[model samples]
Target: MKTDTVITKPLLEIDKSIDALVKQIELLSFVNPTNIEEEKARFFSSKYLTQPVFKYPDINFDRFKLHRKLFKQQIELIEDERIKNLYEDIIYTYSGLIKCIETIGSGKKFYYNSLHCFGTPTEIDVENAKYILHFEDEDLDSQAFAPKYNAKEAESFFRAYSEQYDFTYHIKHSDKISAIAMVSNNAKTLVLNTNHVYSDNEIAVLTNHEIGVHMVTTMNGLLHPLKIFSHGFPNNEETQEGLAVFAEYMSNNLTVTRLKELAYRVIAVNSLSKGYSFSKTFRLLHNQYDLEKEAAYYITVRAHRGGGFTKDYLYLTGLKKVYDYYHANKNLSLLLTGKVSLEYADDIESLIEKGLAVPAKHITDAYAENSNTNKTVDFILKNLK
Candidate 1:
C-alpha cells in the first residue's frame, strides 16, 4: 500500500561498499623513508599478489578533465554550487599526491602537476638545480643549545605538549637528519632524525613549523565531519608548509635567510633530478653558489637521501606559491586544518560555507596558544590580502 522511495536497493549497495572501503583504508599509514634503491628493490621484489582492479572511465588530458570528473562524482554529491566549485577548483591537487609518489619511484624531476603549478618537466632538472645555505657565527654558536634527539628531549616535548593538549603522542629520532613530524587522527608524533645536526634557528623553526602548525592542523582536521580532513587534499603540502613558515613570520621568527634556505632547497632538489652525485651537487652549492660546506652538505644530503631525488624542493616552492596565493586574496583557512595547499582553499571554504565542511568524528588534543588566534589571523590578513 506504501509508495516506494526514490532511492533503490542497488544504489544503497554502492553507498555501503564505499563506506566500507573508506573505513578499511582510513587509518592506514604508510611511512617509507627509504632511499630510491631500497624502494625500487621493494617494489620489484614484492610477489604479484592478487589485487582487485577497477577501470574508471579514462580521464582525458584535456584542460579541466579532473574538474569535470569531480563535478560528475565528488562535487555533485555535495548539492551546493559554492562548495562544489571549491572542490572543482582543487581537483588538480591530487596531481601533487601522485607526483610525490611518482618522484619517489622515478628519479628527480619536476612537472606541471596541475594547471596552477609548474616545475621540472623532465628527469634531468633534478640534477641541474643549485642550492646555498647561509648562517652567521652566532647562529652556529646557538646550535650547541639546540635539543638533542634523545629520549630526554623527545619525552620532555611530548609530555609537555601532551599535557597542554591532553592527548598522547609519540617521538621518533634519527641521528643523521633534522626532524620530521607525522600526524594522524588521535595522535601526533615527531621524528628527530637530524636533531644533532640542526642549529638553534633551525630547531625553533622546525618545532613551531612541525608541532605548532602541522600537528595542530592534523588535530583540527580530525575534528571535522569528513574523513578527508585527515587524508588531506592533493598537493596540500604547499599551503601547509607556507602556513608553517607564515606562522614563523607571525611569531616574529621568519628571516630572509630562511627564505633563501628554502630557495636553495629547490635548487638543490632540481639538481638531483639531473643525476648529480652528492659530491658534485656539493661542489655546485659550495663553489658555484658560494655556500658553506655544512650548508651545502645539508642540501646535498636532501637530494642524495632518496637516491639522488629532489622532491624536497617542493617545500620551498610550495611555500612561495601558497604565500603568493594568500596575497592574491585567496581562502587561507583550509590550510589551518592539515597538509592542504592554497589551490584547494577556495574549494574547501565553499564547502564549509555550505555546511558541507562538517567536522570529523574524532580528534586529538589542541595545542595551547599563548596568544590569540585572531591576532595572528588578522596579522596575516593584513599582510596577505
Candidate 2:
C-alpha cells in the first residue's frame, strides 16, 4: 500500500494460493512425537538401554496432492524477479519440509531428509558445545534454578505476560512437546508441557522467548499483505530460534544452565551425524557428559526424534550470529518483522518499499534495554567459534 506502482491481481492471487497451501504444512505440528510421555516412561523403565519407539501425529493432508498443488502455482506471473526468486526458494523449502514430515519415524530415511532440511552440526559447533560444558553451573540454592511452579501457574504467568502486548493468543497444556514450551505459529497458540515444572527465571525466559518474540512475530506476520511473512521465509528457523533465545539473554533471564542446555543440544545433535543411536546419544550426554538421566533422555529424544533432527543445534549457532549482529549495532527490529531470516533483511526492506510488506507492529521489549549483567556468559558468547 506504500508504493506508487499498481499491485498485480495475478501476484496477489498466487500469493494467496501459496499461503493457503503452506499454512497446512507447519512442520512443528507433525515433527513432535504424539506419544512422548509413553515413550519416556518406557525408556526410563528400561534403565536407558532400550531404544524408545516414538509415535508422531498423523499427516492429515495428502502430501503428494499438496506437492502437486504447490508446484501448480504460476509463480512466473509475478513481474518482480527478486520476488519470483524468493517464492521459488520458498516452494522448494516447503517441499523439503513435506518430505521431512512424510518420512517421520522411518529411521535413517527421515534422518537424511532432516539433514537436507536442517544441516548437521559442524566440528566447530561441537567444540562450542564442549566449551560451554567446561563452565561450572550456577549455585543450586539460587531461586532462579528452583522449579516451583506448575503448568497451571505457567499458564497464569503467560496470560499476565500477554497483557503487555495488544495481541490475543491461546495457551494450551500438552504432554507431546519436546521443549517445555513452544509457540505454534499457524494456530497462534503457546503450547506448554503439562508434566514439566517451571522455575521463576524459566517463566520469564519463556514469556520473552515464546510470547515476546514468537507470538509478537506471529501477530505481526498476520498484518502483512504478503502471507509468506506469516508462513515464514526459507530457512527462517535459525533466525527465529536465535531471536527467541536472544530475547532470554536481553531480558537477563538466560542462565548458564540454560546456555549449557543449548550446548548439550549441539552435542546431542552432533552425535546423530556420527551415527549414534538414541541410547548412544543418551549415554554420551549422561555418562560422558554427566547430565542427569532425565535431562539427558529429553535432550536425546529431541535430537533422535523424527529421525536425527538437527534443528536443535541451531540455537547456539543462531545465538552467536544474532549476538554478533547486535554488537555491530544492527537494526534488530528489522529482523523482528515476522518469521523472517536475517539474510533477507534487504529483501524484506524491498517488500516494504514495494507495498508487499510492512514494518513490525510489535517490537520485542527485551531489545529496548541492555539488562544483561552476566559478564561470564558474555565472555563465552563472544568467544564462540
Candidate 3:
C-alpha cells in the first residue's frame, strides 16, 4: 500500500483555504450562457443576421470577500521561494478570473479582460489555421461517421470507457453548453449537449478527449498534498486542452475533419480580434469557408460569447506544443500531475521533492501507445506554421 506524503503545516492550511475559496469561482459556471439554445434559435430565425443575446448565470458568491480572503493567506510563511511565487501567481490568476466573470456581457470590457486572461491568437497561429483549412476534408457520409448515439447513449459509452480507470464521475445532459460535451473539473461531472447526435468516431474522440486526459487530471489533482493542483496552475487551460486533443490523436480517432474544426476555432477567434460581430464571423465560416450553418454558428458563438472569448484559439497552439513535446521525448507524465502547465514541470518536480505533490494517480490510457494511422493528419500537424 502507498503512504501519504507529508506537506508542511502552514503550506497545507493556506492551500486548503485557497482551495475552498477557489472552488466557488469555477469560470465555466459563469461563462457558459444559460440561454444558448434560445439565442441560437433567434440567431437562425433572423436568417443568421442577429447577434446572440446571451444570458449568464448570476454570480452567487461575494467577489470582494473572496478576493480579500485569497490575498490574506499567509503565503509569506511558506519558506520555499518557488512555492511561494506559485501561490502568489495562482491568487492573481483567480483574481483575474473573478474580474472576467464580473465583466461578462459588458462588451469591450469583458473582451479586454478575456484578452488579459486568455490572449488572442498570433499571426503565425492565424496562418497555421489557414494552412489546415487548405486541406481536403474526409468523407462525412462514410459509415463510420454516421451520427447515431443520443446523449444518454453517449453517457453509456463514456461510462464504459471510463471503467478501465478507477475513477467515478457524474454525466449529465444540458442544453446550455456550447460544446457537444465538456468536463466540469470542480464538479467531477461530464456535461453533454442534449441535442447532439454522436458519431462512432466522435464517441471515441470524446472518450479520450474528455475522460482520458481531463478527468484523469481531475482525479490525479485530488491525490496531491497541495490543492493548487486541483484548482490549477497559472495558464493551465492551454496545456489541459492540448493534452485532451492529443489523446484523440494517440487513439487514432483524430481526423482531418477534427483538425479543421480546431482550425476553424482559430479563425473564429482571430475574427474576434478584427472586431467581427457574431453574424460576420458566422459568414466568414459559412459563406467564405463553407462550413455547415449549425457548425459555423456554434464556433461563432464560442468566440463571440462573453464578449469575445479568445480561449478557443489556444486548442490548436496547445496541440502543436504537446505534439512537439511528445516527439522530443520529454516527461509527459509530469504534465499530467494535475491541471499543470509545461512551463512548470520543474516546479512540479520541486513540489514532489518537498513531498507536496505526487505522480498522477491515473494516466491517460491513450498515451500508452500511438495508434494514429492518418498520415495526412500527421503531415498537417508537422507542417503547422
**Strongest candidate by TM-score:** 2
lDDT of 1 by residue, 25-120 (tens): 211121133332333234234421211111112212332443343334444454445544544444444433333333332333322222123343
How many clashes (backbone N, Cα, C below 3 Å) per candidate? 26, 0, 0
On lDDT, the leading prediction is 3
Candidate 1 residue 259 C-alpha distance from true site, Å: 2.7
RMSD after CA superposition, every candidate: 10.3, 1.3, 1.9
Ranking by TM-score: 2, 3, 1
lDDT of 2 by residue, 107-168 (tens): 99989998898898899999999999999987644777689888988899999988889999
Stretch of 10 with least lDDT, candidate 2: 1-10
lDDT of each: 0.47, 0.89, 0.90
Q: Residues 1-385, candidate 3: write the lDDT tens digits.
A: 2323343677888999999899988888888888988888898899989888899989899988988888899999887788889999998999989889888899899999999998999999999999998999876557778889999988999999999999899999998889999999999999999989998988989999999999999999999978999889988999999999999999999999999999999999999889988899999999999999999988988898889898999999999999999999988999998999988989998888767789877999999999998999999999887
True-vs-predicted CA distance for residue 267, candidate 1, Å: 1.3
Could you estimate the TM-score for every candidate? 0.60, 0.97, 0.96
Candidate 1 regions exceeding 4 Å error are 1-118, 121-151, 161-168, 175-187, 194-200, 273-275, 304-310, 321-332, 358-385
Model 1 clashing-pair count: 26
CA-RMSD of model 3? 1.9
